[model samples]
Target: MKALIIAATAAASLVSTAALAQQAAPQNPGPVIPGVCTYYNARLLAQSSAGQAVETRMQQLAQEVQGELQPYATAIQTEATALQSGGASIPADQLNQRRQALQQRAQEAQQLEATRENELRYTLGTQRQKITEAVSPILTALYQEKGCGLLLDRESVFMMNPAMDLTDVAIQRLNAALPTLTFNRMPVPAQ
Candidate 1:
């Protein structure tokens, strides 16, 4: 009886394993309307060729800014170290002057940082606008080509079928149309 029960348990386990193995993986649902409506994923902009170029350019600009500021930082650090080590030996008036000069240098460095940040922000915004301008016509052409009567921004939707996504096609078209974008640190206009 014990042997028979063990054999039955083994058979049952094998049968369950076989059933699980036969089950199919979940498939993506098709679009509700094959061509009448589609969605564009705006978040996918970063994956496009132009977007990549912008990112690379931004990195280069950031590195340049760091290089430009490094000397100012080193000078400030050197003066600060000198003041900290020998401030007691200096005459009162001279010490005060040195402290004030150090403070002024720090303030200047801060101002330069703010200015560079503003320039970087301006450059980023302008580059994004250029990319948007380039993408707009491509999206329009895709809408027409797909016979889509309704176009939805992916951000605005709650849920969507994979078939309705046009982001990949849009990126492909964008790569073929505008491969790379060139941009510079746009000077921030005086407020």
Candidate 2:
């Protein structure tokens, strides 16, 4: 994760600094981009989207799985309890059958859980992709239109001038252009 952050910072810094450097920029740059650097809070930016639908959908998926998966728990518990309470008194053949049945049910429950997890990962990936697709262009257009020398996520910066923040501006622009995102529920191809 730290590597990822460093890479992103390096990339954003290169683009903005290179632009200014080409035009006779400073050797030792200031923390703030004096005239053209803009910063934004990532968390706030995420919420600015129409309906915050990606997050909402993710929550819905979790809830749906939770509700459905409860039955698996109940079934496993019942089988285990019956075995623990009476296996010693039962005929050996009957006991063996029950144990086998219990193992089969456990395998099915595990498969259901694995499916739920795959659904979760798929939902998160697609929802984020949808949001990024809609937001990136808008940010780029604003950055170019504003002629910013640099754009940095506010989370990376220690301090900056309040006026230099572009989050609000970006949010307004994004909302106007993409009022809502209607995500596609594409089935993930079997891996």
Candidate 3:
């Protein structure tokens, strides 16, 4: 009966010790550090005023190309209409030949369009790189000044309080620092 009482006391002591240990565990209940979290989108920065200027220039170039190609496009349409109207009067072989010629012309037009697209992409990519390069030093300065411990992309964040957003500040700083940045002009080959 004494051994049973001692065993019961020991079990109670162990349980009490465990409960005490759990309660003694340390916890952090302090407020979070300000400026420790930051986020921005480099793409958005690139699309600012400087980026818009680059796009405007590209659009102008496209318009010029379109003007030059307008006559050819009209000629192609006219020829197609003529072929359609003269259908059976044209020999089968001749008709096939004309069709092939029209197909070739269409392919050429498509090729020109593809080339222009590639050129525009290259131009835009180069401009974007320039903008990124210019903005990086400013971003580094901002990070240092703001004491940002973690910087993330705006797009990657699911939810962020308005206070957490530094994009507007960055944009304002960038715009002030670089009001108008000229992109590297793409060289056109002389005919």
Per-residue lDDT of 1-191 in model 1, one digit per residue for the tens? 22323533554564454345435313655446856555444433566888778767877887788888889999999999999999889999999999999999999998997788778878877887887887789889888887888888764655566566678888888888889989788899988
lDDT of 3: 0.63
- Stretches of model 1 off by over 4 angstroms after superposition: 1-26, 34-43, 156-159
How far off is residue 156 in model 3, in Å?
A: 1.6
Backbone clashes in model 2, listed as residue pairs: none
**Residue range 1-191, candidate 2, lDDT tens digits:** 22323533554565465345436634544464554656453543355665366556555666677788889889889989999999899999999999998899899988877777676767567756655677788778877876777787765655555556676777787678777756533456687
Q: Each prediction's TM-score against the native?
A: 0.77, 0.73, 0.68
Worst 10 residues of 2 by lDDT: 1-10
Candidates in order: C-alpha RMSD to true structure = 16.8, 9.1, 22.4
Which tens-of-lDDT digit does each residue in 1-191 have in candidate 3?
22323533554564465446537644742344576555555433444676556556655665666676677688789889989999889999999999999989988877776566555556656776766776788778877887888777755654445455566676676666666655443643445
Candidates arranged by lDDT, highest first: 1, 2, 3
lDDT of 1 at 141: 86
Give the top-scoring candidate (TM-score): 1
